[model samples]
Target chain A: MAEGQFCNKSTVNTEEGIRHLLSDTNGKTYYKEMEALEVDSAAIQATFSKTLKSRLKTWLEICTHCGLCADSCFYYLANEKAPNQVPSYKIQSTLGELVKRKGKVDAKFMMDAMDTAWSKCTCCNRCSQYCPFGIDMGIMFGYLRGILYSQGFVPWEMKIGAGMHRVYQAQMDITSEDWVDTVEWMEEETEEEYLGLKIPIDKENADIIYTVNAREPKHYPEDIAEAAALFHITGEDWTVPSVGWEETSIAMFAGDWEACKIQVESVYDAMERLKPKRMVVTECGHAYRATVTEGPYWAGLKDGKTPVESIHYVEWVAEVLRNGKLKLDPTKKIKEPVTYQDSCNYIRNAGLSNDARYIMSMIAEDFREMKPSKEHNFCCGGGGGLNGIGRYRKQRDAGLAVKHKQIMDTGAKLVISPCHNCWDAIRDLEEVYEDGIRWSFLKPILLKMAIIPEHMIPKDE
Target chain B: MLYDYVTGPIALISLVIFFVGITARVVLYIRGLDWRLDRVTYTVNVKYGIKGALRSLFFWMMPYGTRSWRVKPIVTFFVFALHIGVLFTPIFLSAHNIILKEKFNFSFFTIPDALADILTIIVIVSAVVLLIRRLVLPEVRNITDFKDYMMIAITIAPFLTGFLAYHQAGDSQFWTIVHIISGEIMLVAIPFTKLSHFVMFFCTRVQIGMDYGIKRGGMKKGYSGQNW
Candidate 1:
């Protein structure tokens, strides 16, 4: 089991213990799938042809192996400084070896490569922030995943999620009808609290086409209601489309460019049909990044211009607050000291750190900053679709040790994370570390603090 | 006669290789420019990108931008000092300028002999510190390969020989010839080894800042307090 080999007893579960838990489960299928894949040089070269570029080449060539990036990785810190967990080592062993071998490798090497690329590294890009060379390891790992994905070697969870997106147009496989019903249900639920609240659906030419993660509909319907309530009070013209409504992209995480293209194309098509001036994505980090940053290129847009402007909901809300569209009641602030967990995509990828912090300061009465907040903040160990992969639960949990210590040092009662994956990972950490800290999305906190005008209040209320 | 050949023909060949090889690499990178259209969907703010690129170039020149400074402040200081020393010594040192004046018929700048000596000492001492760290630190040592050590030796040779020649410590003429030869070797090796980072560092940083800083909205006027 190698108990306490990688991490302290408090944070790390024994490998043997994890194996025991997975003995009867489908976790064993992942390794079997890796072993079963028919990998060859041609396929490997084809993958590289699709993924490789000058930037990646420069990164591979210029990395000095300064080891500065080691401290930036949560897995490295959590795993008692395992050298293999170092970001450069991960790239060196997998991509480095592949390049060294000229794309000729055996199945055992592929197995090791897959584990290193998919399981160990989360593609969070925190190391890039620390890298003196400015090498984005996250993008590098994404390319590695793309190569592995071409070989049909991916975690089962990712495969299922990508399939669900292809078939059902949502990561959770929620049907269009179910999506509509869920929004309608959320409207009804919110109506009970604030009368005359409506979740406008399929409205054309709206100022904003608001989209949400499939998890909002399938699991956390309250988040939908919370967002709806905020929009209702703020008097913003927003609508949710039934088709292409789910913004999360499992295809992007799985590195299936075709599937990723389909997911993004659907959303862009929806936006084009609805003719929204802008699209506001809910608190899903990867979804927002995939749509706003990477979607245009995936869709083959020449100039990197989308049909419609896109903004993360955090940025949208902050803009709305700055524009005086909605007033926040200082008296209704959260009494407990709170800290914000900067999502890697939102902060590092999108530069929304200040916007999120600006919103939090307006809402939280006592806001304490994490020691290393914003772009430098450690990943919550759930990025790169690792949260969805059930086979790596123990590894992901142990990886939370670095984040756990960061949160504990803040001495805050509540941690507000703006991204779905960050929220889920932090919640898992709460359970794993038994840290009695509560977690909430920024939407709920915003809804709690926004002062509703008397005229906007329901007549019944 | 051997010293003259090493200082004249070999040195000239090394310079030719250095410039030609570096120019080729740069040309290749230019041809391979990744429009980065995948990650940036809007009209790139070139003005902001250039500004951010310049800012990042200067920011990382010091040790303040990374957290490793906190863990190994001494190493950080030495590394930073070494960079400063190596970059300035060749360009501004009076001895190098005398040679430049004779060969190229022009000299742009010259530092005092004492200052040049001090900078040379900084380079030599920092090289030692870096080498020791590479050997001692498991994290650093694991990544350290033969080429890494070779590059370090190649880099140190010129500075060490130059310092010895300047001081006329032992066989001053012999040391001077060794310094010129070693310096020539380094010039030839720069574009071929990890030393290429010396030329590509700014290009890479500029791309990073342009993509991340301008496109991703981190391009604030000053250090945005984000790690970058």
Candidate 2:
């Protein structure tokens, strides 16, 4: 077993990262945008105040503080089982602050509490699973963040996520033109491999609507290329909506509940308009978890029933593999030690962690387990809009010791984290804590292993 | 003999307090249920079907006189013993039991000599342990409201009186009178007091579960699970 004593690093390199995160005039304009959109600030405040009572009541009532909750917390486990890192303490600190002030605390308290609540605890809900009394601190924090967002006390970086959601109803802030251009670019790149394959956009009566995370278009176009290649090889009937295809809803992360509800609703509306048989979320844990699980009802999708079916990318990939649509040359992708980091939103929330591992095994020859895998996976310490807030670097790095050690223990040079936030958060952890573990999406690895028959090299030479 | 137990003032006060307490609790429970169920938003997930809802409801009913096999039998019995003894002892028996017998010729079940004595001891001991647990455990301590202590005190009074009256120990009848008055006070206090948690728990759980289940894919098969 790996070991480490608890260390609290409070010194934030504020000047370095905080400059990038300062909310500009454009950011402040979101309040106006919301007002223009008829969002009632006073109504929202009242709703938040009401929510605070239930949230506080739940906080005060549910926990029996058995401390068994601490044993399974990745943060606590990493910190030599320190009492402070215990999952309950995070809730206790904020709830105590709220009670002490009777919800009349100043903005400074909001900033401090939001950072501690959001940056420190990933919304993995792993502690909820392990708690003897089933206290859902993650959900509680989600509400706390929501209340904070209503008050406009949101940290700078998280505002971007909500801004993206407000602007495009997506996470990555990829504009409509950018999405079309990215798809066209990827389609061109993949056509060289598929001869004359086309990635359809807004095609009516398609069997499925393939949605991609904003990261694929915003930063990692190759990830989208792999998705195109897989679909091209499979000959599956899929379409990407030019209007509403960006899948990740950072509004959900920013604790902008109304914004999140709208974003989720837009996806449903797109699905209904296209009348697709199903919706396939490309390699995003939170996107899939929210769309298929939490977001639908929150958006009032329960009047009748949800329109289109939804499945995670792992499930789709496994289906494609089973159907003999994709062939793989595992040897090409098997060079170094490889391990899978289960995304919490997918593993615990969506139950796709094993499906991801099963997919990983097909491509990586050196696939190994990260001890406590699947539903029990640790958070990457970058959830709940932590990465969005540049002010949280110190706590993010220091609090993520559990995930850092888990990655280190696997001794794997390559770690495949399927979710975009995990990739960002884990990569940030590597840089800040100097715990180097090469991280990439599983899609890229699968691309290296995948072989289209037409592109296959001849055996005779 | 009848006059020996309940004089005019005890009967009048006991009946009035008991009626008012029961009415208030029922009203609060109904109102709280309406408000909680009418809530527009909920976050928890409940997957079990109507079968599950009934299971949860019926299981909770065990301490209220309905029993179920699925819940923890021993724990349920202990809890049931505590609840029933608290509810029935002063209001229905011992003090009020004596008052009705002496004044109105209305008698409920008299606790048998053996069971009564055994249960009286258990009730007092369990109340002390529960109070100590509330005080000692940090999690429990953190959430404990002031009303919780009062409820515990109200619950334990009858058992304490029964203990004193068992041996006719030291003006035991006067102590029994004190127990009857306190029990009546609790009934009047129950609806307005946090003791309504007794009824609120089921409604809230059901509401939370339904909200969660409908949000999760279990409610709608082909609907896009997206939250909007």
Candidate 3:
């Protein structure tokens, strides 16, 4: 409630929010990428050169280092006392050096600045919380990262994260065929539990359009099965797109604004084309946050363009429970105590704090709160592509100590995190932080644990 | 001695400036119109609410908690020397004493006879050092905006007038008047301009004290110098 404090902690507190929101406008090369098939090599290089010079100049002139920005950074806190890691100080070292040198600085400076701007930062906006001056140092660094990204100066591992967005629009790189096959396969598997329940694909006039993060199709396909199972038990008339239903947007995180636009556009265009009554995004935090809160603004699609109603999975599940579409036995309970891990994007970014709790109450009996839970939740160490970098293991673990402590204090046998990044990040913390807690996504856990009355199960046979 | 005639106008301007300047500075602080020290470091409250605005306003007033104390060595030393000279010279000096008495009926604070002369000399020298540093240092040079360059210029004008008025060398009264008026103009501008960085500087140090002394936390923790 402090004057500068924001309810959207994920954007204002996390490195990705700091980097992505501020740096959203950085990808000027997106135009070039679109023209890459036609433009000559020299011209492309020249444009890049001009973009770098102009962006760097703007970066240098704007910043006045007051050091207030360093206070809230998780990385800054985790690293003991290093001045250079502070957002303002970090900008001063790289962009500041370039300004001081007037572009006379060599490639070595570029390389060094690139390393600090991209690899060292999680692009979380937590530092922005402490800055009294309203300097979006994360945005400044994000722009610089965009320029470096254009130059192929990013760490290779980070490239995979970006490339996943580039090739598949999701971090796990699921293809259209992969998505269809995966959903169809999961729907068939669910038939044993619900007779001939359907995972409707691209159904016209359906009440809701559903999207899943690529990670589900690629790795945790069973989680999608659980979601499908929930839909079947509720008899919800929802349809998943044959394609463009992948909701992860790494382009936003990587500072590639054009790619961000494209990824978001893919979904929006799909919405317009499909005209589903409402869209339900799966539990991936960033994608859901971006589609509803940020994508509309960033893509120049303001209040009018896509008012197709958007809801997160938590909201959808709560709707089913409230509507009595699904019969959930309140007497049904999990064997052990369970607690909810509020995804930063869900609680802070999308205002889903109550939604997660509401959904949790329907499924789990012993739901306990983590201290400073909901909007004030700490990021899972791997949320913002930190898990992608092999070298960041120590730093990631160190930054996650606060989260580990929160989880340990909960003393719950199960942790239900709704976001894939939280899922992976907490799983890593389980191994590294030694909490030894079993975890599952909220929707999946609910589907598996909740007792569905026989009347709710589809009589497809 | 005849310089008193010219200095009379400058002294009158200085007096007017003092009244108007203090009033304006206080008004801005009370209204929270001035930019906050935390804006650069914290998440600026972009939404509507009294709580967010007031929180920002509170920290803006007492920024000692947010700003850094590790002033660049040259910057710190010269700034300190200059502030002492500037703050003391106008109030304590005999030449100005005559004008204040004639104009507003005010006089020196303490040890005026000795301290006035010493403070005047320090003020003049420090102002010159500041001008030179602004031009010479690259990092400082990059950060210094046009207003910064002009601050040094404005600062020097008053001191020069005072110095000239002291020696009774040139239009002493006029120089004295110019010095007093310019000094007063600056006092009024202090709260509004980046010069209010003084407010932030003090607040930053205070915050460090509270954070370390009361919170009992390591005050200087941070990450490696990575860009993103």
Candidate 4:
């Protein structure tokens, strides 16, 4: 270890190390301690050597430092165009330098990497699209985070986040029993509206297997109930697995590859066991990105794909509505000015922008696009686990200005975002900016706007 | 003797080194790829990869094709102009072709002397502006290191010496020999230094272009436009 003011240092690759770190301190103390901890030159060099390859090496070498990537970054735009916020500078200073120096960096350099990795970037990949050479800072930063993670230079929430996946197979401590209970309770509670809403659990060979972010079960159980209500109205045969219900991977955000595999493998395991025709993940962005795209590789599947074909919530809902399985009440459509928040994980990263916009057209009468729409839209500011990292609260909030201004410019009071992360970001942005903005996840908005069938309507109503 | 050795023997050695080094580096880069890193198959269409690459390569080359290009109109204009001058001036200049024809009995069609002069001046002026931009811009300066400065200096050296030699600046023979040596140094440095981007740019650009075209741009089998 290079000499510095060494503090709470632990080998976090082990289960015991993660357990100790999670129990002993919170996000703030852990961050403070990690910042002070000495840099492990051996660990950095080992990880760097392992990850160094043709594509990443070329990306670092080929960068011309043209600085065009600065405008594409929301952090740069939101931070008054800070020079440090430039995507090229941010990646080059940390990951690029690490490769250049063969990872022989000091404590000061590691601390800089820690701050820039978690706080400065959310891994939105917007800059990736804008780059002429297609140098993805998001991918580079992700690789950088793994190296940082090996040395235990990680955010407190992210450490706990990966631990949660390792322990409970969810981002939170929601057991299989708890998830089943929540679905049953939601079915009963929402029955008053739909009369008979059934949330089938672990039903083998169901046409659709639905998964959700743990936050839905842990914080917003109503989201689960609302999804149940939609499936009920649409008359689709969907079942939620009691064992692998949670789909979001905080481990992916933390660059903890082991925890990522654990979380994604559980879901894949359920799919293989039950053999659903297709899987529909809830309105979560990163969850969809993880499962649909990245998870197959993490799980080491032969085809590099999930066992069953899976689609996002918006993809399923839009198809259902378009094919006339479910109808939207024209009279009940939102009349107020509304805008759509594009989730980087799904909308940009997954090319679900049009699917989301098509849903918006059906749900809202007065839909407006923010300054940039579709794949060109900026990040929601609270992406890549930044929303949950307490140490970066100030920077995260400050970064919301670009998004806040985008919404204000649209003059939309209601924002319809299809992804859970985007929903949280918009809600938080409205709360902090106090622009009198209101927001919703697609589940609630779909439930409110989706017309109930004549037969399924409540008897009393 | 110095001029003859440099222009005749050393120049040939530099060309051989340049070509062989590039070939070896390309092979090493391909072999260095850890298949485990890319074990998972990309969902995007492999067929459109080349098409996408060409699209982005030429599109980015356009004066205002990208948002970044549009953002700074003057920089875009200057960059494209500089590229044209740098690439064309040396190849089309009549003096260089005469030397090539005398040595190898083969020469490319040459431009008029005055046109060559104008292009040389443009490249020289652009190099100076680019150097100043690197020094002055806070963001660019922050990332710029001694190596970057040295690379920039090496790139401009041949152009500056060629311009002086063409104009018969004091001791024309001396200027011409120095220009030949500097040009050869640049050729040898291409594969070893960051100038590898001259070749690797296609690889990086095409890979990303394919990424956008197949995966995120929704060119998959079932999911087409509007359906996405």
Candidate 5:
């Protein structure tokens, strides 16, 4: 009902007399079903009563309408600072109102809530840091999204993303055999350079169980290759399970709670089966968040922990560097004015800020810190699955302007982003800004700078 | 007759409801917290939970402690001043202390009457600025429902009436009665309405601090090399 609130101006808000527009870019089948889906108010009310817990109920009751969370959100700051863009307004107009009305919301109201849930806010949780009452709008939005998903009003990719995790146990459609082939393929390509390099599969009692983002195998197998080589040179024993190898949960992003449980249990299942000493996730932010931080709770693990110890890719790299297990060639260090993207998932959510800085200090000669670094760094605008939503591309780019300015202000030619979401956002941001900025995942930079032991180096060479 | 009933019984009832209602709200939320989902706390380094909560509470209490508070120092000043005046003036005012001394045979320390007057004036000025900000600022105005405007009015009523009654600007007896009634109403509203934030702020800080502490590896005991 507010201005600049809908994802698209033509987006139909009510199932009754709703306009049907073809969606070509976002997931085709899901978007069509969503468009045609009935707006069942009774179902929405039933779902609300079922899900409303004490924490959210109390939070909803306590908000003072201070409008303080406005500047804390990039969506509010970057979108010309509209009133509706404010975090409080976004949640209040949608979920807050839904609660106040006891979920007597109409089809149009649900549509408006859907718009705010997905498009207006990326659920970055930055606002939670600044909220005087600690009203985590991100967490509230996560709950709101569950309501939306139950009523079949979720975004295109989200529905499909949840489906992917449910059907494939991975966010992508890659089968178990395909994942193994990709891991082996990467090892084959990289094994020539480093002796004793192996992509072990389902190796029980290994020291490490390495889980990777499904995106790595589908789009960038080189990341797997680089990880294998680094592990080989460090003399670390790690195995990738055929099943439960995909660590990223788009279901988590989609707010499909049941699917989130299914997805995270897959990884936890791997940990219980293989009995690794620890699990090390790849350089994907949400993957680390889903499997390690939030996944434990979803799977009902004790004290919010995985079965074995779990570490981020950055943490493992930083630890190896510190312990002298991984050595970097001084000559290959990043020489230009370089900046590190403080990824939201691990750095802010998981407290891996020091480890990322350690890696930056180790590898970069001219490392420049963003103005607000560490836990306070702004979101990369693509978090909360903003990168893949085709319908909200313009809004996503507008939000990118906030991070774009943060990056450009450092005047760094090269930006090292350790998380896949941040890296992807940078890549997309660079496409538009074209500031001659080079973006990288931490794996590539580490692989480039890491020194291979002479003994581990090929004897023929 | 109305004054006798209002001051004698209604005031006592208001106090009972205010304290009992707020306690029940806090206890219910804490009790209802699903150990599986909401109450996420650290395992090894539980000290970080206390430390983080204290840090968040301390930083948020100061005028320019958080960046959000620092963004608009002018608003922060009004908000901080308003809160200080609202919290302390009711406790330390001579008239209220005198009433407490008469009823309970005890009284807390009292501020100089001049200082209380100044604090009351600060509260009114801050309330007006906040109200104006809500009306004029488009970002604020959109979220400004009738209930928000009512909350502001309810918050300022006792202070405004007390200031008028103290100065004998109007019918002094009437204004005093209004002040007493308004103050009682405000207290009763706290546990029932959004005004509950006064006490809920501490509860939320405790919950959120643990959330951040456990996630951030505040004490470096985190499973990940979250030595950050």
Candidate 6:
């Protein structure tokens, strides 16, 4: 075969999609920023040396080019075997090129590298599982992101989000006052639906310090209301923090370690002051991973020495159900056949598959299992901050075809994803494809199905 | 004189280079370890990590454990057989054992001559199949380079020449000399080229298991229950 002739004729014309991306205003902004960024070889080398680990070196050396990992990549499968989109090819072209050049490449090369590292791949890590040697493509891409981030080549949306986190300590720039106001508003809204429901803010010594994605307040305030109703119904002492309320970490996704560190530290600082037994993060995949799995390290807290335990909201909900503290009303369960979208960070990264499934089973009348579910599930094409990066929407939408087919094959009326990013991406797919399928977060379904005992009900109601 | 040079001094030098080079490479790899002091700990179950490493080693050895076995069974079989032959034949072949016994008075378990012949044929055939694959498959061919082809040739030479010498199909002395020289070249090349995989494979697998098994706490009851 001719060189660079690796893509089959059947492959989707990704060039057109890329063209669409470049035509967008956000994409133009991203291009302009990348153009303005100075290409310094010394800086690139420093960042690479800093991020390149022994494990990554072994991974680079040991690949036999078996092409088996291609089967695991949704881009390869969905794009009709586009060789460039293959996981190995993606890594080899970007990281491999970087290593070969010793970080002395130019702007055009860095742009191509950024395209492959950021826009094309989602860093979901399914390829790592299929790799016989277990080369983690996700971690490798993360390191690549770090290198690019150090060079100031981050996408505009990611940069904005990270900047927001650095300034306001929350994604979407939700200030401390706005955060408290949203909580109070949700508390009142939830009180009208469920008597005596209160979305506590900055409650000291609470059992759980609840945190949420900023999207919960900005776009989907009902999620906050639903979570509040669940807490009130269960008679649990869970308080939303006035500060560090947003659990989502665009900084981590943007590969800004300093910003990521600050974002994680803010949450821990709030938890430390609140003295909560545990910090229960709302259903946001990257947020849970950032705070619970990666937070302590970023915050300079030693392993096993975190000030408080961090748990995903799904885990907390599952625990509540297991402890019999919350009862599910089967009669009030979601009547539609629902399927669960396993968020990559949650299932693959955090090993919370069982809890997610259990929560779905408890709330939904019929939970349809998508093919290749759980940790092996394909990304919603919005992972690794791709959903936040509007510049790559066309590529993101094209990749969503794989997820659309998976969801369609399940024949479920509603697909429930606990992750805000997955929910957003899947919702986009729903609209774009006109699939006539609704999507939701786990909080709404749980609130609707959970039964509160008569004694727990407010006396006035 | 040729035989003595090929089998004696050359052999010793190759062995020295192989051992020292591998040791140095391994040391370099260890020294290069980032240790990721800044990484947070989800869990530190070293026991599970050990178990997971052993499990991965075994799982990957069997073709059934990988998805490739189903998708590309022919290639998978050839690759698997190639690894078995290349790894086992060197230690177990009667001739190699005899040489070891003569040189260092070291001999281990020996495979029957018939089994050795079968393994030799498998190795030779698998090498050819792998070469054809490198030449034929578009994606694989794209990555294939002179070094890849040279590695295959280096691997195949000893077995091919050994088979010819054993059967006396060619001049026995010539075949034996070629075989000894080829074997020496392979030994010396192991630490320098793609052949390093013979040593690094275990290290890489174990490190992966440690990361996913111990740090991630995903390994449960000998199976990584994360996916299922």
Top-DockQ candidate index: 5
| Tens-digit lDDT track of model 3 for A206-239 | 8888988877888888878888777777777888
lDDT by residue for model 5 (B1-228), tens:
878887989999999999999999889877766646563754544677677777778778878988778877898999999999999999999999999999999999999999999999999999999999988888778877787887888899999999999999879989988988999999899888888887888888777777776655554544332111
Q: How many residue pairs clash in each candidate?
A: 1, 16, 45, 0, 0, 0
Tens digit per residue, CA lDDT, model 5, A1-461: 22112122122323221212223344465444444455656766777666677778877877777887888899998989988799888898899888788767665677678878888877778888777888899989988988887776777677667777887888777889999999999889988888768899999999999999999899999989999988998889999999999889888877788888988899889989999999999988889888888888898776667899999898899889999999999889888999999888887788878888888999999999987788778999899988988878888998899889999899897988988899999999989899988988888788788888887788763
- Model 3: per-residue Cα lDDT at residue A218: 83
- The Cα RMSD of model 3 versus the native structure comes to 12.8
Q: What is the C-alpha RMSD of each candidate to the true structure, in Å?
A: 6.1, 8.9, 12.8, 3.1, 4.9, 6.4
True contacts kept of each: 0.46, 0.03, 0.02, 0.56, 0.58, 0.42
Rank order (by lDDT, best first) = 5, 4, 1, 6, 2, 3
In angstroms, how far off is A283's CA in candidate 3? 0.9
lDDT of 2 by residue, A1-461 (tens): 11101101111123322233334443444322322232233544565455545424543444434344565666666666655667777777775556555666544565566666666676777765444223567777776676666655555556556656765666655678888999999988877666657889888889889887787888888777788777776778988888778667777776777667777787887887888998888877778766666665566654423467788787888778767787787568676788887887766665455467668777777788886777667787776667666566776677677777788888886788878778887888788667567888767666677776664322443
Misplaced by over 4 Å in model 4 are A1-29, A32-38, B38-45, B98-109, B214-228
Give the per-residue Cα lDDT of candidate 2 at A125: 73
The regions of model 1 sitting more than 4 angstroms off are A1-27, A49-51, A455-461, B36-44, B63-72, B219-227
Name model 2 segments beyond 4 Å from true: A1-45, A48-105, A120-137, A289-294, A297-299, A304-306, A321-342, A351-378, A404-416, A429-440, A448-461, B1-171, B181-195, B217-228
For model 6, the superposed segments whose C-alpha errors exceed 4 Å read: A1-30, A304-306, A455-461, B37-45, B66-72, B217-228
Candidate 3 lDDT: 0.59
lDDT string, candidate 4, B1-228, tens digits: 898899888999999998998888777766765434643234434555455566667777777887667767876777777778878888878988998899889999999989988887787788778778888877677777777877777778898999889889999999998899999988898888877766776667766665555444445344442111
Error of 3 at A161 (Å): 4.0
lDDT by residue (B1-228, candidate 3, tens digit) is: 534643456546655665665566445433432112111111221222233334334553342422221213454555567777776666666765775676578776544556766776777777777667656644345445577666666766777766676677877767766766676667655554555544533333233222122111111122111111
State every prediction's TM-score relative to the real structure. 0.92, 0.71, 0.63, 0.93, 0.93, 0.91
Model 1 C-alpha lDDT per residue in residues A67-139, reported as the tens digit of each score? 8888888898999998777888889888988977868987678768877777788888887777777887888
Q: All models, DockQ values?
A: 0.47, 0.10, 0.06, 0.46, 0.48, 0.44
In terms of lDDT, the poorest run of 10 residues in model 6 chain B is B219-228
What digit string (tens of lDDT, one per residue) describes model 6 on residues A1-461?
21111111111124443333335556564466465456778877776677676678778776777677887888777787776777887888888888878998877787788778888788888888787678878878887887776665667666566667777777775678887888888887667667777777789999999888888888878888888888888889888788877777888887877888888888888988889988888988989877777776777764423478777788888889989888888799888788999988878777777888888778878899988888788999889898877668788888898999999998896998888889889989987899798888877777667787775456763
Highest lDDT: which candidate?
5
Pick out the ten consecutive residues of candidate 4 chain A with the lowest summed lDDT: A1-10
lDDT of model 4 at residue A132? 64
DockQ of 4: 0.46
Q: Indicate whether candidate 1 or candidate 6 has the larger lDDT.
A: 1
lDDT of 1 at B130: 86
Model 4's chain B yields a TM-score of 0.88
